[model samples]
Target: MVQLGSRAGAPGRHVVLCAEQISKSFAGVRALHNVDFDLRHGEVHALMGENGAGKSTLMKILAGVHTSYDGSIQVEGQAASFSGVRDAEEAGIAIIHQELNLVPELSVAANIFLGREPLIGGVLIDRRSMIRAAERLLARLGVTIPPETRISGLRVGEQQLVEIAKALSLNARILIMDEPTSALSSSECDTLFKIVRQLASEGVAIIYTSHRIEEVLELADRVTVLRDGRRVVTAPIGELSRGAIISAMVGREITANESGKTAQDGAVVLSVRNLTLDTLGPHGWRRTLHGVSFELRRGEILGIGGLLGSGRTEILESIFGVSRGWRDGNIAIDGAPVDINSPADAYRLGVALVSEDRKERGLHLGASICDNVALPSIGVLSRFGLRSFASERALAADMVKRLSVRCSGIGQDVAALSGGNQQKVVIGKWLGTEPRILLLDEPTRGIDIGAKQEIYRLIFDLAAQGLGIIVVTSEMPELLLLSDRILVMCEGRQTGILARENATQEQVMRLAAPGMAAWSQVSAS
Candidate 1:
């Protein structure tokens, strides 16, 4: 492991990687500007900022993903420029992007050595040796996954581990992990942290990017804040607090408005009984949701909280027709049973769902903002084999103004907006359909505080108009603030449900965990 001098003035040490005057642009937008960064050997440097803060752009330049960047890179005190990722890898640099890059049908070993495979007899590919090498790498990282298993057969966490192994196979001295824990379970994250510590101990310089503030403070040795394509601040982890870091990233004061929701007495509008989804386990084992049920009244907000695989998301999806199977469940809208066999069927039944994966499943990125907003209600705007563009624009314009969606115009592409505004577009599409019951899955994920406030205001407005809302969230504070009633799920079952006035963070977390003694009592009550 190479040693480096700390900011506190230490002895002779080597700076493994250095960047000076890094500038990058896409189209006409400057993604990064004069960014100077240096990584010492055996250090985990965290890049902190909100979405679209140029952190990823800067890292992409270092990984050679963006070859057009104007910058001088010095590795071992020698000026260098990489034309491609292969060039960077040859220079001992590798990056594991936030999005998984692997062929689902391919085996773990195949993915590890995809571009550079070992050859045998100067002709045939060595399959057995590749699997053996993959197994060895997995063993070194303290992760247990069969090398012969296809990536499609593995969980998201296991696939992420495969990516890490792929980088390690390059003998990369500098590793960049982008949002590594975004899709990991708590135990899987612990395993990843252990591996990260091991790599740091072996003098591997890591540049980590994550939105989770707590994890950054715990793992990163030094933190760098970027805002609006410029470097804002750099300091050791101990020198900055969470509040200070957030301020640096946004360059302004940010605050969350705690919802003071008053208790509501309203008639039931939507009811679900015995909803279930069949799920496959690690080794082709099947698990079923055992008789999940819930009810929401008009002018009321219901919150769902659970672990990642606890069937919370599945339940909402089932209600919205995202999951299609023989659902032996009773779904009632306004005291009338309805068969929601498809998304269109659910929409006709006055039920709208904002899916968790907004970018992929909900919004059409290439479509204009007006078109995306009118997608759910395009039928209403159509007339005699022709659609009213004026009406569509008017509807979308009103929604954009009402939701405070910051966009250039109604003609702007949905992809041009920020994460928060994109989310508003998702909600707008549903609201334009004019559903009586709304189902939201992580609506506020990856958004800023001002946008969050706008979303909360919209939810409250809909509820006040006698609409029923069901929100599924991983954030405890969001669950507490926005819910009139809370339902907690664990291990494919309902663990507890509480009235919002009586629910606390401590109480919610206790019930949300698997196999607690309060499960039966809380469920019964």
Candidate 2:
């Protein structure tokens, strides 16, 4: 490593990177405005903001992903400009995006060294050398995944670590990370923290961005908050509190726990009985869900909690009629039996699902916001087999304003929007379908604190309007705060259901955990 400035823990070190008067715009909409940022060697500088707050736009400029920004960049106190990602990489700068970028069929080594694999005699690829190099990098970072393992074989957490390893393999001096731990579990997040600290200690300047407040408090050396495409505040991490960060990000005194849930004992809206789902795998037929039964009442928020592969997502997807290995299910709406063979069937019955993988299962990124939001309701908004563009635009415009989705216009592609904004579009699209029952899976998975509060408020408001909502989340606090009742699942089984007044995090986790003692007791009960 090329040592620079003082070692870790030494304040006032040598400046590694700086940006001045950075501004960017897209199609007449300013995404970033006069943003200035600087980073020192061996420091973790957290970029804080809600989605569409211009944090990503600023970082994209730094990483050479957006080269048209009006700004001046300095590296080692010398003016520099990058033409593309290649220029950024050559300048010792690299970024790991929140969305994992890897080919699933390839081995870990291949993904780590993609586009620049080692070669023998400057011709054929050197697979052996690449694997060895990848192994060395992973081992140095304390990651234990085998280099020969296919990327698809690893869990999401492991995949994240691989991304980190790939960035480090480039010997990047300035590392930009966006929402690096969003998909990780608690233990996995701890592991990532260790790796981050280790990298910082090695004199790497890390520009970290995340919606997680506690993480910023624990990991950041300095914090720069952006709001509405402008720099709001820049302060040392020690001088800021979680509440202060939240207040700065959203310009409001919104508490971290902004749950406004009240008493919910309305009539039953949806009911299920002995819903079993099966799938065929390499090992032949296997049950992904077994004898699951639950009831969702009108105006009730039902939270489902479980570990990965605990069949939490499977339950919601099965109900929406969109999941493999889904069969032998009995479903009813308002005490009337229903047959749903597909998502179309589910939609016709006034059921809407906001799927977990937004990229793959939810929104149409390449399409305009108007099209994506009006997708489910196109039939109703059409005349003589042609869409009424006026009504489509009106519906999208109304939902966008109602959801507070930050966008240039309804004509802009959904892909151009930020993650939170994209999520809001997904929800808005389903609302256009006019569903009585809403199923949300990991609804706020990667959204920031401010966006989360807004979403929670939306959920509360939707439930208040007598919509039955079922939410599946890995975050326990979200489960506890939003749900009128919580259901814990463990290994394809419905372990337990607890009322909001009596449900505890410990109790819910015990039931969600597969081998816990409470699992057997809850299943029996």
Best by lDDT: 2
Runs off by more than 4 Å, candidate 1: 1-13, 107-109, 117-165, 168-171, 279-285, 447-461, 501-510, 514-521
lDDT of each: 0.81, 0.85
Residue clash pairs of candidate 1: none
Cα lDDT tens digits for candidate 2, 178-230: 99887665545666777778788888899999888888888888999999899
lDDT: worst 10-residue window of model 1: 2-11
Could you tell me how far off, in angstroms, the CA of residue 92 lies in candidate 1 after the best superposition?
2.2
lDDT of 2 at 228: 89
Model 1 per-residue lDDT tens digits across residues 4-72: 323232112468889998988888899888988988887888997877789888888889898888879
Give the per-residue Cα lDDT of candidate 2 at 51: 83
Scored by Cα lDDT, where does model 2 land? 0.85
Cα TM-score per model: 0.87, 0.86
